[model samples]
Target: MTEKAQNINLNKAKSNKKDEFYTQLSDIERELKHYKKHFRGKVVYCNCDDPRVSNFFHYFSYNFEKLGLKKLITTCYKSQDMDLFSTNNAERAIYLEYEGDKNGNMLPDASDIGIKQLNGDGDFRSEESIELLKQADIVVTNPPFSLFREYIAQLIDHDKKFIIVGHQNAIKYKEIFPLIRDNKLWLGFGFKGGAAHFINKHYEDYATAADRKEGMIRVSGVHWFTNIDLKKRHEDLILYKNYNPEEYQKYENFDAINVNKTKDIPIDYDGFMGVPITFMDKYNPEQFEIIGVGIANSGLEIGIQPYKPEHKYYRKEVQKRGAVNGDLYMMINGVVTVPYTRIIIKSKKL
Candidate 1:
């Protein structure tokens, strides 16, 4: 699709309010396997989940004793935690608190679950939820994607460790990038194939070419963001490319060289290189220093490359090599456009 058409679709998606993406149990196990050790004796809050269908609750409750969790709390948006096909009869938001099985059964059964009403609608920002947040040691949930920024801010504000799902595109957000740049957050083991198939009661089926299940929507560009450290965050990305000015050209409006692909980062180059936002998944804090991000009118203290839909993307060819007058833009065959969101960086000693 043309850049202009893509932007129109993206704009519509940005304002869209369809945020009911139910994560499958398999996806939970994929990432949570690495975090089991952190949950011991800690209260886990799946504050944005529906206890009736939340795999998060399902997983933790079943593994509560194994993980040494003190308690498991789940809050649902409004009163929508009933059977998927049930008619609406409730008006108040609700929550469920599980303190593990009381009997010798060692299983988290429905009889042992305690369901309660919330004084508010259970928005994660509600005072009641904030009180619960204060009680939690770790927050884990697939929050509403549209509110990812606000949701993550709340967690960071409370200094809570979290494992949550959001779009990979969020890495460029002003509120999010600084956290990554400062090493306060990093991407978790992302969704397989960089796409997630989510279930929803509202959508019938998107019928996309990826994995399409009944009542499911396939969303690409999804990733998990967290504060917890992982082994991948410390591993170095092997570099093999050498700098060639003909292939690595400067941006039309920025001073940094444009790296079309992360693997193509040259070992000999030391200056700032603007790599794709996906670089976060493979980012090793020890190997590269995150300088900043570049976007159109970002005014980010680092650099800015304003997004222009009319411009076409070119591969390894430059129309012009821009100067440092602060207004230089990289052109390809005389066509100028904004590059994709990039995570600015420079390599460390090999």
Candidate 2:
């Protein structure tokens, strides 16, 4: 498993409350900078946040007129108390709609916002939320981490435009990769340094080199996934490394060279090369063409010997080394070893 996959696994094993991380406003600001043009005259829905404290609400409501937004909507899950803020409120659920500052105060205040009670617990899948979704032009929120696939499916099903938060590893999901392959979805200007700090009220926290708070959990591999267009995504990567067999080892299971780092990509090589997932951050679709992943039987798979992960003999061979998940493999000589799931690419630069 890659470091990212392992971190996600550790989070899953330790926290059943995988969906509770609160996104910080600063992170939102950094990403929203590139999508301002899309919000004009558009209905932005924040289905997974509470307007009272949600930065999504604050960001949109505060800049409502400036962004030329037509409307803004926000909803929260069950009103059951998770903390003092969730307490002192009704036990059901609620939703809010704002049409920007009605008065001339230049702020979206109580008078400009509409608050309504919901019949359901405000589950995004509930009919009540679906009705609201139909009225939305764009959706934005950090949804339940564990239910990311389901949440994204709903948005795509509705054909809604959106900007949402998800882990970088989500790129490899069977349902997601096809969209990427077809250019239906792509990554946004990711959180600074491929990591984000979120508010975690349900558990104890510690400090990182980035923050000194106890309630904050720094999630690495966090990124912004969006269908919106941005100039940065088209910026080409400058490569200097030339293909050298001694440095770029060919994987035994696949007929391709293993590039341990993105920067080390061989500029002269015209063939397929397996590179790290981190390469996606600096990836420019106009420059490098993504082919496929390095999975067994994946259409891009190749070797003198075919890959068979389920073969009884192959399973036993991998078991002796360590836990073997769906990650791709590379053999050094005759020894079978796992490599991080690589994004197979046929360089356009070459």
Top candidate on TM-score is: 2
Off by over 4 Å in 2: 1-19, 79-90, 206-212, 296-319, 322-327
Q: Which pairs, if any, clash in model 1? A: 251-330, 252-328, 252-329, 252-330, 253-328, 253-329, 296-305, 296-306, 319-331
Question: How much does candidate 2 score in TM-score?
Answer: 0.87
- Compose the digit string of candidate 1's lDDT tens values, residues 1-350: 23344334435544444435578889999989988889999999998788887888999999999999999999977746422222223587889999998887999987889999998877889999999999999999988666788998999999999999887778878898889999999999989888777776554444455467677666667788999999889888888989999999887666689887888988989888889888888999999999887753343466564433333223223434322222225677776644666777888873
lDDT of 2 by residue, 71-190 (tens): 999987774322212222447788999998878999987988999989988878899999999999999987766677888899999999889988877888777877876678888988
- Compute the lDDT of residue 224 as modeled in candidate 2: 89
What is candidate 1's TM-score against the reference?
Answer: 0.85
Candidate 2 lDDT: 0.76
The per-prediction tally of clashing pairs is 9, 0
